[model samples]
Target: MRVLMRQSAFALILSGLATPGALAAGSHLVSSQKLDWETATKLASEAVRICAAQGYSVTAAVVDPSGHQQAVVKGDTVPLQSLSVSYRKAYTAFSYGQAFDKNTTSELINAKLAGPENGALNTIPEVLFVPGGVTLRKADHRVIGGLGVSGAPGGDKDEACAKDAVAELQGEFQ
Candidate 1:
C-alpha cells in the first residue's frame, strides 16, 4: 500500500505540470487566429478616422502574428516619412507579440536575441522602437498581432489613433 501511494503521488505531480503546459500551448494557437484580415481592415479604418478628427494626417499599419504587414493606410496630408515608421511599428508589435515600448524591453531583447548581428528581430526593415505601436488582443486578452499609426503629433498621439482604430472594430473583435 505504501509503494502504491508513492507512485500515485508521483503521477499526480507529473500530471499537474503537464496540464499547465498543455493549456498554454492550446491558448497560443487560438490567440494567433485573431489576427485576421477583417479585423485588420476595420482597425485601419478606425485609426484613419481618429487621426483625421484630431487634425493630424497620419499613416497606419496593421501586422499579422508573425509581424508581417497586412494593411497600410495613409491620409492625404500625411508626410512621406510617416509611412515607413508606421509600417515598422506594426511589424515590431507583430514580431514580438507585444506593444511597442521605447523602454528597456526592446533594448534587452535587441541586445540578446535581436538585430542583424543575431539574425532575428532586425530581419524586418524599418521597424521603429517608438511607443505608438500596440499589440492587438483577442477575446481572451491574448496578443495576436499589432496596430501602428504614425505622422500624428507624436508617438503618444499615434498610439491614441491606433486605439481609436481598435475601438472602431471593437464590435467585430468582441
Candidate 2:
C-alpha cells in the first residue's frame, strides 16, 4: 500500500498534476467579469413593482447573463414554497433563452424531451412549467438573462406581470 501511494504521488508530480487547484486560480477566471450588483437590484425592483400593480402579490427573480441569481423579491402574499419555482423559472429562461410553457398541456408532449432531465420545457428543478417567464434581451437581440414572476391567480396574469416589467426595462436593458 505504501509503495503504491508513493508511486502515484511521484507520477502526479512528474505529470505536473500535483497542484490541481492551480488550474482554477489562473488569470482567465479573474478576468471574467459579471454584471454589477446595482444594475441587477434595479431591474429586480422594477419587476416587483409591476407585479404589485397587477394585484398578483408575486415573487420575481432575475438572473445574470450566466444564469446566476442577481436579485429576487417575494411579495407579502406570495407563499414561501413558491420561491424556488420562481427562481428556477428565471434560470430556465436565461439558460434556455425562451419563455416558459406548460408541458403536458400541449399536444406535442414528447415525454422523452419534456421532462426535467430532457431537452424540453420544464426540464429543470423548481421551474414553473407555465408561460410566465421572459428573456431579457439586449439591443442587438442578444439574450442577457431572464425575469420570472409567479403567485398570480392565473398563469396568464403572471406572464402579464413579466411582460410589463420587461417593457418598463427596455431602455435600461438596451
Candidate 3:
C-alpha cells in the first residue's frame, strides 16, 4: 500500500498536478539580454582596430552572458595563443560580472584582489583574474555580455582596447 501511494504521488508531481504545499516554495525567475552575433562581431572588430591603432597586434573576443563566445577577431601578426587568452578573458568577465552583480570586470578583480579573498579566485578554472576584460551592460545596469583583448604588451593596454570597443557601442545598447 505504501509503495502504491509513493508511485501515485510521484506520478502526480510529474504531471504537475501536485498541490502548492506539496511542492517546494519560492522560485526565482531571471531575465537577461543576449548579445547577438552581429553586435559581437562588430565589437570584436572594433577592439582589434583599437589595439592596432596603438601598434599592437591583438586578438579580441566577445562572449554572451553565459560565457559562450559569440565572436572573435585576430589581428595580423598576433600570436596563436592570443585566441585562447582572449576567450578566457571574455569568459572570466562574464562569469565574474554575473557572480558579483557588477557592471565591470575590472572593478571586481580589483576588489577581490584587495580583499581577503586575494588569490582565491584563481582556483576556478578558466577564470583569469587579469585585466583586459570588461563587461557590457544595458541602460538599466543589466550585464549583457563581455569583451576581452589579448596579445598587447600589457594587460592594461588590452583592457584599454576592450573599453574602447564597449564605448563605441554604448549608444546601441539601449
**TM-scores of all candidate predictions against the true structure:** 0.65, 0.65, 0.76
Model 3, range 1-174, lDDT digits (tens) per residue? Answer: 979966766554432335334534422222346777888899999999999999999999988866788899999999998998888888877767765765455777667641355666676777787788887777866667788899999889999999988999887776
Which regions in candidate 3 have their CA more than 4 angstroms from the true location?
1-31, 113-118
**Candidates by lDDT, descending order:** 3, 1, 2
Where is model 2 more than 4 Å wrong at Cα? 1-35, 98-123, 126-128
Q: Which whole-number lDDT from 0 to 100 does residue 3 have in model 1?
A: 92
User: Which of candidates 2 and 3 reaches a greater TM-score?
Assistant: 3
Q: Candidate 2: deviation at residue 66, Å?
A: 1.8
List lDDT for all candidates, in order.
Answer: 0.66, 0.61, 0.78
Report model 3's TM-score to 2 decimal places: 0.76
lDDT (10s digit) by residue, model 1, range 1-174 = 979955654443332222344444543221135556766877886798888998989988887755677888789988988888888877665555443332212332554434555565555565555656766665655555678888988887887778767766766765
How would you encode candidate 2's per-residue C-alpha lDDT over 84-155 as one tens digit per residue? 766776766665453222211121122232355554455446444455666776665555677777788865
Predicted model with the maximum TM-score: 3
lDDT: worst 10-residue window of model 2: 102-111
